[model samples]
Target chain A: MDSLDIVFTGFLISALRSATPLLLTLLGECLGQRTGVINLGAEGQMLVGAMAGYGATAAFGNPWVGLLAGAGAGVALSAVHALLVVGAQANQFASGLAVWMLGFGLSAYFGAALVGQQVTAFDSIDVGAAAQWPVIGSVIAGMTPTVLLALLLVPVIGLWFYRTRTGLRWRAVGESPAAARAAGVSPATVQIQAVLVGGLLSGLGGAALSVDYTRTWAEGMSAGRGLVAVGLVIVARWNPWWTLPAALLFGGAEALSLRLQTADTPISAQLLHILPYLVSLVVLTLTCLRRSDSGTPAGLKAVMDR
Target chain B: MRDLMLSGPGRVVGTTLAVLMLTGAFFLAIGRDPVELMGLIVRSAAGDGYAITESLVRATPILLCALATALPARLGLITVGAEGQLYFGALLGTGFVLANLGATSAAPYMAMIVVAMLAGAAWALLPAVLRSHLGVNETISTLLVNYVAALLVTWVVYGPWKSAANLGWPATADFPEAFKPSTFFDSRVHSGLWIAIGLAVLLHWTFVRTRWGLTLDVLRSNPRAGIAAGLNWRRNVLLTMALGGMLAGLAGILETASIQGRLQANLSAGAGLSGFLVAWLARNHCLRIIPMSLLVGALLASGDGLQMFANVPSSIALVVQGLLFVAVLLVGGYANRLQVRRG
Candidate 1:
């Protein structure tokens, strides 16, 4: 292959790698929002997951166990959110912020000792004969189990949301709790379940960051990806299928930024680093303007209306 | 029984006790003596004149940021963008100082502050306009812009504005001695404290005594009636958001000029988030924010002392702060539920 072809292939693989965590997080948040619960604490959930996942891997020497620990950490944090928003009827936004702060502090406290420590991390799978075939082969070889799982879950969730009774009930709760309750579908139970699933996916995303993507732990390492996932959900218009393209857009920006730092370029690296966040902001604003609440869950509209 | 528990004093005492117990439990979990550490925290935060001043120094930015959050919240807007506004403000203020590097006049210093405030207001206006004109959620928009603003600051400090004298440190040149804000009582506490306190009083009066206060109330409680009463919701939202942004901007500049002596990355140090928590704890009451900020500021200030004396990571303070927020939320939520049941 030519130099240009090699560079393009490298960029595609890196984009997919970077996009995996965000894809996991967006899918989780998308599920929760579908149940009429807007979780603003995904960032916090991701942080705790990252820290706990890293710590667990270092302790147990197993990446799968680390992933489970991360998911459990996320569920533990979201339980607080569920208590506040569903159980006590506290403001969802405020509760989520509090949860974020809790996660930030707790992770920093517990993970302080684990900083700079190394553990065995997930490796990209070698896809045998397909690994030698052109661009697609290179991409397939780059896919770790977590990455492939994240990709697979996209269609699985999409089908579940549109092609099942449980999916209809979830959507019903998101649209109108009162109506759902009248139909004998408990909005509270559905919301709690959706939030837990959101937490689980977000935790898995965080674990992916520590155990799969970076393979090292740092304070606030999730950066704004969890929050970015929140914006991607809106940009995807809450559709399970559109999340793939939405995450790739952000991931591609991140990959390009990293690539630009090594290449001869006039643009400052810091400026390039701003690309993903700036793109998310612009895309979110444009989406909000164009759609003007066309596909928003009515229950969410009730929360954000004023 | 419900009335007593929901009463003002009852709520205060309950929250305090709950926070203390949770903090104590956390210390125990970490294998530390809860009682000794709690006492140490309070003493270190405000035991002596020096400790009090240090806390006030920490409280200055938090007070300003709290007011920033409170102002927008009065009009029913939730903005987590004060951190961004603060950074943008510091960036512009530093730009002014960098441009007029040789000048030693008080006029330039004042002008720098104004420029910073304007920059913060401009940063805030983007989300305000989106929320008002397009019905975008202010919380998410503000949160997104925050990342952009912080990156903008990072870009400048590491690139165009980097200080060569610092020998690779990603910070701007130190403010000229003439540019530094005057300190108080041989402490880091500066005139910003007075400004924040004065602004709190002014805001409290405005909310209680002025026509604008009632207008915000009408708008918040009933937008249709407010519109019928000729109060412009869009204009009011823009005004509140801009004003809040200006205060947060002032905080950024004051912290840069008075505390750090230079513009650097991560300069706000979570002051914006802490401020938001304080404002929420105070329930967005302008006057109540004063004490709440000082209290939270004291808690944060003790982190250093905790590290030195107890050999614990200073981040334990953050854990305590988070516990305090959860404690308040639980108590407040329970009280509200009781009140609703009683009615």
Candidate 2:
């Protein structure tokens, strides 16, 4: 293969790798929105989760244990979010912002020791001899376990939203809580569950970064991926099914930018680095142009109103 | 009916105790001495004139940044983008000073401040426009613009504006001492603290005593009624956000001129978030912002002192702030619930 082909192959692999965490976060936020609460705490949750996953993996010698620990940490943090947002009906934005700081502080304080520690990243799922298949194998190549799980969730969540009774209740609660309450479904309970689950997946997203992707702990290893994932969820139109492609688009943009950075180019490095965020803004602007909100949860929209 | 509720001081004390206890538990879990940490926080924050002065320096920017959100907050727009606004302000302020490097001090100083405020306000208005006109969420728009501002700063420092003398660190050339803000007695704490104080007082009066302020409160709580009553909701949105951004701009100028002395990475250093937290803790009462900013500033100083003295992660302070914020909200919520029950 020529250099171009080599670069193309590398881009595809990197894009898939980058997409894992974003996909997890987008799905998490989607669930939270569907339950009438939009948790802006994903950024902080991801940070604490990253540290928890990395620290646990280092101590326990099991990546799965680390992943679970990360999810548990996220859930614990989100419990605070649930109380402030759902129970008290505090300003969701302020409450979420506070939680974000809390989680970040927790990570920095707890993971001060974990910084720079490395762990063996979880290996991709093993395929039989068919891995030797030329073109197809390259496309379906090595991916962490979390990536596989995220892909599986696409179908599972889509089915759950459409087919299950619980899913219908979630939509109802999200659309009109008073109506759902009249039907004997507690919107509060559904919101709490969804927020916790959102935290759980966000934690997994953090794990996908520290345990399976970066394989090393750092102060802010999750960076702004958590926040970006939340925005992409908007572009995804609050559909869990759409999050997969939206996340891939982000990850792909990220991968392409990194590749461009290494090439001999005239663009400033900072300008190129900003390409991903600019893409998010431009895409979001375009989405808004098409529709104020493609399909917002009315329950979630009500919380935003003054 | 009003007297049936918990008094304001009672709620404050209750929230304070809860936060302290929760933070103590966290410190203990992390293998630190909670008692020592508590004492250390107080000592480092206000144990001496030097420390008190440092806290004031930090509070200057914190107060200004808080206004960036609190002003818009009264209008019921979530403009947490103050952090980015600060950067835009600093970037412009830095550019102004550098471009007019040879001009006599008076006009340049005035120019830099004005330019910084305008730049910050302009950055803030981006999200307001997006939100009011397009129905996009201002929170997300403001949030994303923040990253864009940071990136612009980074590009400038590393590219066209790099200081050749800084030994490869990505920073702009230092400002001449004449360009720096005038300082008060015995310390680095500059005149910016007065601006913070003066602005706080003015904003409080505007929000509480003026018709415009009442209309803004009305606009926030009931937009339809405000619009129906001939209050300009859209204009209110722009004005409040612009005022907020202008305050945050002053913070950026103070940061670049008084503290950093040159543009560099980490200039804002979470000032925007800290400001937002201070605003929330103050409950958006403009007059209360001063004390809240001071409290947070002291905590920041104490955190740094803890890092130096006990080898503790400074972020422990953030954990405390977060606890305090949540605890305060919870107490307020509980008090509201109690009143509802009684009714």
Q: Which lDDT tens digits does candidate 2 get at residues B267-296?
A: 887889889988888878988899999999
Candidate 1 residue A93 C-alpha distance from true site, Å: 0.9
- Cα displacement (Å) at residue B114, model 2: 1.1
The fnat score for candidate 2 comes to: 0.59
lDDT of 1 by residue, B92-138 (tens): 99999999989887899899989999999999999999999988889
lDDT of 2 by residue, A1-306 (tens): 467766776787788788888788889889898878888889889988999999999998889989999999889999998998888777788778888888888898889999777676676678667557675466566655887788898889989987899999999999999999999999999999999998999998998789988788887677677777777877888888999888888788888877888886888778887777778877887787787654788887787554
Give chain A TM for each model in order: 0.96, 0.94
Off by over 4 Å in 1: A1-5, A132-134
Q: List DockQ for all candidates.
A: 0.71, 0.65
Worst 10 residues of 1 chain A by lDDT: A119-128
Error of 1 at A35 (Å): 1.1
Q: Per-residue lDDT for A1-306 in model 1, tens only?
A: 788878888898899889998999899999898888888889989999999999999999999999999999999888888888888787778888888888889999899999989999676577789989987777788788888989999999999999999999999999999999999999999999999999999998999899889999998888889889988898999899999999999999999999989896888998898899988888898898795677788888877776
Residue B194 error, candidate 2, Å? 0.6
Assess the local accuracy of residue B78 in candidate 1 as a C-alpha lDDT between 0 and 100. 88
Distance from true location, Cα of B284 in model 2, Å: 1.5
lDDT of 2 at A250: 76
- TM-score, structure 2 vs. true: 0.95
